[model samples]
Target: MKVLVTGGAGYIGSHAVQRLLRDGHDVAVLDNLGRGHREAVEALRASSGKEIPLLEADLQDRAVIAARLRELGTEAIMNFAALAYVGESVTDPLRYYENNTAGVVSLLQAMQDAGVKRFVHSSTCATYGEPEVMPIREDTPQSPINPYGWSKLFVERVLADHAAAEPGFAYAALRYFNVAGSDPDAVIGEDHHPETHLIPVLLNTALGKRESATIFGLDYPTPDGTCIRDYIHVSDLIDAHVAVMNELDPDREDRRQMIFNLGTGKGLSVKQIIDAVKEVTGVDFPVEHGDRRPGDPPSLYADPRKIREQLGWSASITDATTMVRDAWKWFQENPSGYASQA
Candidate 1:
């Protein structure tokens, strides 16, 4: 299958592209390079030894997307193009809506015109803001407290609307849980300008990128009075994408809009993660407790039974200690994210 991966130059997007190619599908990457790095794309080509065509373009512009889709003869689109900063989303809601929500609108139109049959949308668990249930399921109602979460929820609804109006179009919205860790080979890993992911932040502190780690709000109603979250490896998350495409093809009659939550059913608390990092890195660093960041929940995890029963897939993630070690390997190898980008 020939597919176009929007935002394919970013961390998770690049990982997804690598997996798609490894699974025997042809992929073309389209990214604007706003938040992504170019070295990641070049590195992917060099490491894989395959010529993965890349276009530096944004989906917000219709002409560029349509031209590229038609030129590439893209059969499917896996969209990962969005500005994902929860705190910033709270302060500047328009940016989040424009990048995440509005960007999808133009991209959807381009796909509709291009006759693209499948779209695997990169959504978030943020859609289930302050989850009322222990293990969040697909049917959970979306009530996002912040604009970022609301923007993701809005795109999910937009995809559902598109599926309803156009039977020719089909999609799978994978609501990703706490995605962490890097590829075991360390060719590509998670990197951001101002990193916020818990694993990376902890590792950065180990590397002295920051003074020390801040455990946000230690008064939560959890085991250690800290927040707990489910962390899924990057490789495990995108594997489910391939399964979704395989399960739902053009001829299938179950044209119903399908939603899948990706994560391990188990979880790790903030304090537990810190301990794991210390154990793996062999470093005893000072831990600081700060005021609770607004728009944060006490505890959140996953119930991946739906994806497991339906897609026959479950997370094969390394232990938190092992995950921390693997991440330490990457950061130690290249303290700065990518060689060229640095």
Candidate 2:
């Protein structure tokens, strides 16, 4: 199958693209290069000896997307495109809504016009907001506290409607937890500018890229006085995407819409992750404490048993030591990230 990845050059998107290709599918990536890097694609090309086709276009422009999809003869679309920052979304709600919510609508519209059917939508656990319990489920009531979660929920609603109305339009919206780790090859990795994610930030601070990482709301109800979360390896998450997208069918009843949670179904506190990083890298990174931010919960993890039992998909790599170690390996190799300056 020939697939189109909407945010193919970004961190998770690029990693997903690599997995799709490994699954014996032809792939073409559509990235605006706004927050994605071209060199990530180039690194794959260098390793595989195949140049991935990439388009420099945004999802807001539907015309260009339609043209690109038609030109590539794409069979399915895996959407990993969105602006995801909780604090920034709080200040700029409209920006998150426009790009994360409305942009998905445009992408779906283009797919509808192109006669494309299968879809693997990249969603987040943010839609679950501060989960009511430690292990969040798929059917839980969505009570998103911030614009970022609301924007994702809006897209999930749209996908549900499309699955009902259109024939042969099958979609699987995988709600991801804290996605960490890097490609085992060490060629491609997380390189978000003005980095916000914890694993990368800790690695950066260890490398002296930043001064210190702040532990927000450390005095929570957890045993370690911090929050714990379910961190999933990016590669394992991508494998699930490939497995679902390949199984999509248009004429099957009660099979068009599938939602799954991607994680190890366990929680790890902030201190545990920091300790793992220090254990892996042999660095004592400085840390500080800050006030609790809005829309943050004490602890949230996933019960990924459904995906494991049904799709034969479980997170095989459950080592935080490796998660931190592999990510630090990539950071060391690409000190300046894909820019080749470090």
TM-score of each: 0.96, 0.97
What TM-score does candidate 2 get on C-alpha atoms? 0.97
Best by lDDT: 2
At residue 238, candidate 2 shows an lDDT of: 90
Which lDDT tens digits does candidate 2 get at residues 49-83? 76789988888888888888889899999999889
What's the residue-level lDDT of 278 in candidate 1?
Answer: 88
Candidate 1 segments whose C-alpha is farther than 4 A from its true place? 339-342
Q: Highest TM-score: give the candidate number.
A: 2
What lDDT is obtained when candidate 2 is compared to the true structure?
A: 0.88
Clash count, candidate 2: 2
Candidate 1 residue-wise lDDT, 246-319, digit = tens: 67665565734668999888879999899998888787887899999887788788889998887789988736
At residue 283, give the lDDT of candidate 1.
78
